[model samples]
Target: MKVLVTGGSGFIASWIRKELLARGHSMLVFDHQDRRQQLADGEEFFLGDVRDATAVTEAAAHCDGIIHLAAVLGTQETISNPRPSAETNILGSLNVFEAAAQYNLPTVYAGVGNHAFRLIGTGCYTITKSAAEDLARMYNLYRDGGRITIVRPVNAYGPGQSVAAPYGTSKVRKIAPSFACRALAGAPIEVYGDGTQISDCVYVADVATAFVNALEYTAVHGPTERPVEVGPIESVTVNDIARLVAEQAAILTGREPVAITHLPMRPGEIPNAVVTSDTSTLKQIGLDAIDFVPLDEGIRRTVDYYAQTWLPGYLAA
Candidate 1:
């Protein structure tokens, strides 16, 4: 099958592209930026934006299905600049759904698990993502619309995640990359609030597998009635994550554990946020046999990636 992957150059989409290629599928990658130096054998990159309906429609042609991953990410970034986020997350998603309906394709949408905790977060990212999910549900109701399956993933983290700006292009501050980079640099790890806030961190590879599984299921069984939740059932506190990163970095770099400093919670972020999910839907989609990467191991790999790829450049400068 040939798949149209919006945001194909992104962190998660990079894994999805690999998964697709491994499963004997071809990809038509559509993104505004041209990030690839060389395309994989079965992959084709198209320079376009999801916000451009014509571009999206043009890219959807000749594809068997769509995996819509384009969006304005980062809670703090979106809160500070909600207009662009809304335009991209909401309007851009609408374009993708419409294009899918027009092409009669199966679509797997990337949604945030934080949508379930909207009242707690109340941020622009959550609001826009929630709207996009609603659009998916609405589009699925069309009799002639493409089969649309929504996969709601919790905090996705692993290697390849960009560190916060000045070092990377990502405007959002993700926990794993932030902590791992700081710990490796021997800088203090900053924890928001009292560090009791809970997050369910899923490895990027596992999240990619869940997405491919969801896409395959939708291809065969049509749109699922409920959003398929992706992540481990277990949860970890922010402080726990910080300490874990510190420990992993200490082991890798032969440095003492870094201090974890508590700061005021940022705008559009939830305090003490806990993620609760029902992953029976994942089982229903034939992901029952999969084992999630343990948090400790995931962090170890993440810290190691940064220590090799990102740390040298960071430390030298």
Candidate 2:
């Protein structure tokens, strides 16, 4: 089967591409070569932008299906430069759906929790993603052959991530990075608001597997997997993620954590939102969270990855 993956050069998209290829599926990538070419090698991608209808159509022309993971990422990042965010995340998705609708193809639409559900104070990223998901669903309503599945992941974390987005750099690094960076700073972790706000987090590999599984399921059956939310064994709190990170860091360095506190909650944040899709439905469709990675192990792996690859030399030292 030939598969088209938009934003194929980014963290999640790259992993999704590899997973697709590993399954022996021919792959084409629909992402702008906007300095992201560094992440791709020769003979790997089709080289196009999702915003360009002509490019997107050509890329999707011969593909069996598409795993739509291309989008502007990170909360603060989207809010900072909403122009590109809107163009790529929202309009780009529109182009994909339009192209798929014309070709009458099957697609798995990837979105985040905040983006799909309208959490308070959500940024343009979520807004666009939410719109895109709806557009995909609407396309399903009109086209008999177009199958659309929506999967909303909450702040996916782990190796191969590039975390310097506005969200991370602006000192609002979601739950995971906020904790890991604090631990690296030898400062106690801090939770915004009461720390009771909850969200899902999944390892990148697990999420990648989920994407492929979703694509396969849609291929086998019709895309009825609306509201697809895959997470770890449990839903966790902000404090839970923080404590876990601090605990893991202590074991890694043999030092006690300093201070863990709570600050003001970011405006429009979801007070409590933990979306866990019914594995039974996924199972029925030949998909399962059978490879769910434990949070502790995932966190340890993520911390090490950031420490080694992303963090500056000074930060590591």
Instruction: Tell me the tens digit of each residue's lDDT in model 1 across 95-168.
Output: 99999999889999999888965666667878988889888888777548658999888888999988886566
Prediction 2 TM-score vs. true: 0.85
Distance from true location, Cα of 268 in model 2, Å: 3.5
Off by over 4 Å in 1: none
CA lDDT of every candidate? 0.87, 0.72
Every model's TM-score:
0.96, 0.85
Q: What tens-digit string does per-residue lDDT give for candidate 2 at 99-159?
A: 8777777788897755545645677777888888778777788865668887766568877
Model 1, TM vs. native: 0.96
Q: Evaluated with TM-score, which candidate comes out highest?
A: 1
**Candidate 2 lowest-lDDT run of ten:** 163-172
